[model samples]
Target: MSTMDKGTGATMRQTAKARRRQAILDHAKRLFAASGFRAVSIEEIGAGAGISGPAVYRHFGSKEDILAELLVGISEYLHAGGAEIAGIGGGSEGAGGSEDAGASVGVGESAGVGAEAREGDPAGVLRRLVDFHLAFALGEPELIRIQDRDLSALPAEARSSLRRLQRQYVSLWVAALRRHAPGLSEEAATVTIHAVFGMVNSTPYVVRRIDTAVVAERLRTAALATLGVADVVAYRK
Candidate 1:
């Protein structure tokens, strides 16, 4: 066979291998999300993907590796999304901008402000942080569940790294709260942010077992309530 033919064949083989790897990961994610990490098996993942059990091993060394990939994927997503929201300009249209400057504002009200103003308005920045988190959790329920359930299965170092990434995400929100409500101590804001996160992250599991509309309404209500609480707390003290 010609050298060119051999090279083309090799490229095709590589492409096919990558596709298979992705397929395995996708199927594994679905299974892990549907059933906690402990309940899912390599064989089940492979069967769902129309591949043999050993084929999964070829792509990921073990179930833990698959879980690692899923968590890493989520971490990357949150990092990128947070950066994007932080980069928005004050004049930008859509969800990231101010409707009017003269309106009454809460201590942490600036948390929801656009990326451009994130540096200037703590409350706006905090608002944006919450929005970014809720957007991700509400949009990717399966990924969230998988991450929450399988996080402990990851190695210590990997777990630490994931925890660091999560903390960094939360820091952005805390900073905004500090700015908007200068009276509140750092410890207070930290606890409040954690509480708000719990409310936001719980929506996925709730949605799975109930009607979609009900889930949607609950998510909205929860978000608004959290924001309202943040606003009240920021200004109250």
Candidate 2:
């Protein structure tokens, strides 16, 4: 048998260790979402991922490790994705990176213009961030649920680190919103951002009643209105 190493977190590695470890993480997420993190056991996680029982420990020390990786993985993924979206080097540092997260990837007004040009308009910037976040909300509902409910189950330092990244993400939106609406005080912008997040995060509940498309549109319009951006309007045919 090939020796098992936990391997670094890179999912693209061509080693079986990397592949099986990723499989464990994937299954863990599905199981954790279906059954709370506390209810699910490592043995079950192994079974779900097609790993033989008792072998799951080789890749992860304990269930808490898996949960920690899951939380950090998503945060880093968002930071990486936000960096990619904003046209920064992958090695770029910080939760928001040097460039704006609202910027689009492979998109620019001209070569070398980068995120600065991509995010030229304030409303456009807010729209891009809203669109990115909404996509995150709609596509990863389970992860969202886990983030909302299971976050506290992790250790305090880990949880605080994850939250600091989240605050940085929020600050990008607040800055962009304030830029678009210069009249808004920092406190007002912060409050509005929280209010819109409250509305957007109620997706699992609100989406049950209306078509997701409809709810998304309403949320987008309402978000712009909350920021007091001019020209906010309903979807026009």
How big is the RMSD of model 2?
A: 6.8
Query: In model 2, which regions exceed 4 Å deviation?
Result: 1-15, 80-119, 205-210, 230-236
**lDDT of the structure predicted as candidate 1:** 0.64
The lDDT values for all models are: 0.64, 0.65
- Considering summed lDDT, which 10 consecutive residues are worst modelled in model 1? 99-108
| Cα error, candidate 1, residue 169 (Å) | 1.4
> For model 2, how does the per-residue alpha-carbon lDDT over 157-207 read when each residue is reduced to its tens digit?
778777876776666667777777888888989888888778777764547
Number of the predicted model whose TM-score against the real structure is largest: 2
Model 2 has an lDDT value of: 0.65
Instruction: Report the lDDT tens digits of candidate 1 across residue range 31-111.
Output: 888888899888999998789998888888888877776675566445444544554323212223222210111011222
TM-score on alpha carbons, each prediction: 0.71, 0.74
Worst 10 residues of 2 by lDDT: 102-111
